[model samples]
Target: MHVVVNAATSADGKLSSRRREQIAISGEKDFARVDRLRADSDAVVVGVGTVLADDPSLTVKDEQLCERRREQGDPEQPARIVVDSTGRTPTDAAIVDDAASTYVCLSEAAPVDRRMDLADRAELVTAGEDRVDLLRAFAALEAAGLERIMVEGGGELIFSLFEAGLVDELRVFVGPTVIGGRDAPTLADGDGFVAEFPTLTLESLERVDDGALLIWRADG
Candidate 1:
């Protein structure tokens, strides 16, 4: 399976949406890149916090991105996946009601009753501890035939996924503007492991419009 991470950050390396709102420093080109990635992916996933905050459709809104997807096979919109460890995504949320399909990855500890209630509109899968199991979640998606995944992250989710060593490619567009806040979010938080080192290798770097793009791969 191929996993791609798409992130937009400010010059100061803050990933948080300014004032807790979308469309912060990141510009059109960067958003288009995200749309294109989603157009080319089999699934797009984000954390529950993002779902609650952004309320995004997660569909390819760019016309070019849509056309490419059609030429490639008229692919159905990428499945919207949410990691709602506590089953907190409201039943009426657009993530469940708007997409052709929405998959909620919750913890095994989450009650099955909550899942059953939403079965008609959303597919719920159990995955991590009191949280969605990142590894098993990917395994389930792979088994279900989603070969490529693009992760649109919120802080904790990115941290957890990277900590689990699950991402195959990382893409970030650093916008020229800076939004500085002492506790603003970052693309990835430190993993809890008391480790000597992590073996990471940079794959490529380039400038996309006014933003910078970075790509990386896991060690092995």
Candidate 2:
């Protein structure tokens, strides 16, 4: 599967404030760009932390884009996938809505009741014992015919993807604003790399609104 990780960060490389709240870092042009990205993907993935913090619908927003997908005999919106180890995704989360197919990747350790609750709203794919095994989950996703995946992330998930060498591309929109806080989330945050950092080759750069878009391909 082709996996792309996309995100918007402030000038200081912060995804959001320490409060973990959603903040608008990109402008209308960038938003439209992201909509196009979503429309082109087979599935859009995110971690549970993002779902809880942003509650994004993860649907294609442009009607023209939806029409184009329909013309190509594709769904109006791409499928949505969430990495929730313990099944903490709220049943009524926007991702679980009928706008698109939703998949919750859970771990075997997730409670049966919680898994049952999510099963009613979304497809459940259980993998790891304590955490959602990304490789296994992605294998299942690929088997289900999702070849192109776009990951709009929370830092933890992004870090994990890179750590597992699953990411194919990294795209970041650096906005003009500055959000400075030590506890703020960065583009990739988990236990950060100490050695043997992931190498990325610059793919492209463009100006979007008041910010810059930098895309890098993962170097093997």
CA lDDT scores, all candidates in order: 0.79, 0.96
| Top model number, lDDT | 2
Per-residue alpha-carbon lDDT of candidate 2 for residues 1-220, written as tens digits (9 for 90 to 100): 9999999999999999999999999999999999999999999999999999999999999999999999999989999999999999999999999999999999999999999999999999999999989999999999999999999999999999999999999999999999999999998999999999999999899998889999999995
Off by over 4 Å in 1: 17-19, 190-199
Instruction: Score residue 23 of candidate 1 by CA lDDT.
Output: 58
**Overall local distance difference test of candidate 1:** 0.79
Quickly count the clashes in candidate 1: 3
In TM-score terms, candidate 2 sits at 0.99
Cα lDDT of model 1 by residue, 116-215, tens digit: 7667678877877787888998899889888899999887888788787787788888888877776677777545447634456788888878878888
